[model samples]
Target: MQDRAEATRNAVLHAAAELFSERGYAATSISDISERSGRTSGAIYFHYTNKEQLALALVDAHFSAWPSVIARHDATARPALEKLVGLSFAVARTFRDDVLVRAGARLWTERKSIDIEMPLPFVDWITTVERLLAQARAAGELAAQAEPSRDAPNLVAAFFGLHTLSDVLDDRMLIEDRLANFWLLLLPGLQADPAPRALLARAGGRVTTGHPARVPDGTER
Candidate 1:
């Protein structure tokens, strides 16, 4: 009985995440989630009291999963600059592969309607970049005039804008090309040695050109 109930709960959450990602919270409905999940309304309500609570749950799930990506990069003993470049690719992969992330990102922009206490999604990302930039500065990896405080937010803003562009173009792979171009343009300003571009070339993988696949269906891929 417990196992069956857990299955039902998972179905509802995945369905809600997909709907929320494709359609903002204002437009999504319990009936919509129910239809997508092929579960009854009672099943959804059993897992969530209402749509607002469900939305918060979805965002929280995304946040919980996000840091593991960073932790993986940190585990590699890579320098802060390498980690910074790696982190951007990891995030692009996340936004491409995870429906919870896509929905959570979409929901974050609609937090005013949810009445929840969740922090803005970008805040944690910006903080993570700030810490990395500080590390880079301490190690003399950054330019002599590079300010961690300023550069961290600028990096976050730049990536955030790129993420938005991927959504508009419906081509997540565009991020890799743009990021390659972005690094080409920005790295000289940020790096003291100018040798770190090799790190991107080594790890950044093939830059594919293709039509954007629709956002993932929130199932763990």
Candidate 2:
């Protein structure tokens, strides 16, 4: 019984997410979710008190998957700057693969007037990036005068722009391509050595075009 109930709940949430993406929150009705999920209106109401609560829940669920991605990158023993670059790629990949994220983006923009508390995932991602920037600064990876909070948002905005482009780009640009390009373009401004010319030269000379290089042993170059 518990399993069945959970399945029903997931179905409703999934259906609602899809519908909410297709139709803005204000335009989507409870009946729309019910019809899409093939569940009765009573079932949806039983799981959620109202559409507003369900919308919040949807946003909550969408963000919940992000921390694990952050954790994986954090566990890597890579340089702080590299970790941040990896995190940006991961976020871009998530936005590409997850329909729920696309829907949530739409919902966020559409309901900007609504007084929904900013989602925790967003807060956490920003905090993580800020922490990384601080770490990079401590390690001499960033310029001495750099400010994490102010600069971190710029990186976040760049990632968001990449995600937005993914929605319209003809041949879905790979996350790595976007990340490498971003790093090439943006890293020079942040780093002391500023390898913009070198990295771009290496990237341009590569045979596979924008494919990330691999060492002779087949590991990522």
Candidate 3:
């Protein structure tokens, strides 16, 4: 009974996520979710009191998504720099492929419409990047000139810009490609030395998902 109930909840969530991804929050209705999920309205209500609750769940999921990906790379015992490179690609894939993430991005943008307080975006990512970058610099995998404190927020901003632009310009198929290019452009400036920089030369095109497929392999945003 518990398993069945969980499955029903997931179906509703999935349905809602897909709709929210395809349509803006204002455009999507409970009836649309019902049709998409094939679950009764009562079932959805049992799990989520309303659409705002569903939106918050996806928003929370997006924020919650980073740790598992980080765990995957952390388990590999690779240099923090390599792990960071792989982590970026992993997140790109998730942003492009995961309905939950896709909806989460949309929901975040539409947060004002939802009555409940949502998690503030990007602070955790900036903090995480700062920590990893410090580790990379300490490991001598990054340049002496590199400043994690300054770079972390910039890196997060750049990544999210790529994430959002790819979605807006071409349905996100170009995300990995764009990120790879961005890495190609960034590494020469960001890495501490030639060898360390080379580690991320293929940044735009590579994926480090053995970590879990999202940081799931990065910044978690």
Candidate 4:
């Protein structure tokens, strides 16, 4: 019975993620999720008290596995800058292919209407980037003028903007391309050696390459 109940909950969450990604949070309804999941309202309410809770659950599910992904990548013993570059591609792919991630990101953008607290997903992302940038600085991979505290937030802002644009244009590949271009443009200003073109090529080569083990029991592929 517990396993069956867990399956039902997953089904509802998956259904909700798809709807939220397609329609945005304000426009999606409990009934829409029910129809998509083929589950009764009672089933959904058993796991989530309301739409807000449901949306939060989707966001939580999307982000919880990210730490594992990061830890695995960090274990590769690569340069911090290289690790950070690879992370960008990994995230772009996730946003492009993962429905729950898309839903969580969309909810973050529309959080005002949902009246939720600042999404932890972005917070965690920024912190990870900050740490990577700091490591890059310490390893002498960055320009003397580069400040990780300053640069990390700016990079994250650019990433957020690019992802949002990708969502709006309905073009996932655009982000992959644009992020490459962003690295090309920014790395020169960041790296002491300023091998922007070569670094850009290397960064591009790393995207969609690493396989962080699947988030267990989550609806991600």
Per-candidate TM-scores read: 0.87, 0.77, 0.88, 0.85
Model 4 agreement with the true structure over 139-176: per-residue lDDT tens digits: 98989999888878888989888777666654464567
Which ranking of candidates, highest lDDT first? 1, 3, 4, 2
Q: Give the winner by lDDT.
A: 1
**Model 3 deviation from native, Cα RMSD in Å:** 6.7
Where in model 2 is the C-alpha error above 4 Å? Answer: 112-122, 143-146, 168-176, 196-221
Please state every model's RMSD to the true fold in angstroms: 5.3, 6.7, 6.7, 7.2
TM-score of 4: 0.85
| Candidate 4 local lDDT, residue 157 | 88
Q: Rate the local accuracy (lDDT) of all candidates.
A: 0.80, 0.72, 0.80, 0.78
- Candidate 2 per-residue lDDT, tens place, 1-221, comes to 99999999989988988888777788889999999999999999999988877788777767776889889988988767777776776676676677677567767776575556756345666788899999888889886667899988777777677656645552234545655666776777877677654544443321224455443466543
Q: After superposition, how far is residue 106 of candidate 2 from its true place, in Å?
A: 2.3
lDDT of 3 by residue, 1-221 (tens): 99999999889888888999998888999889988999888888899999899998988888788789878876887777777878888888988888898899899998888788998988988887888899988898787778999999999999998888778767886566567667767777767676433575543345332121122223232
Score candidate 1 by lDDT: 0.80
Model 4: which residue pairs collide? none
Clashing pairs in 1: none
- Pitting candidate 1 against candidate 2, the one with the higher TM-score is 1
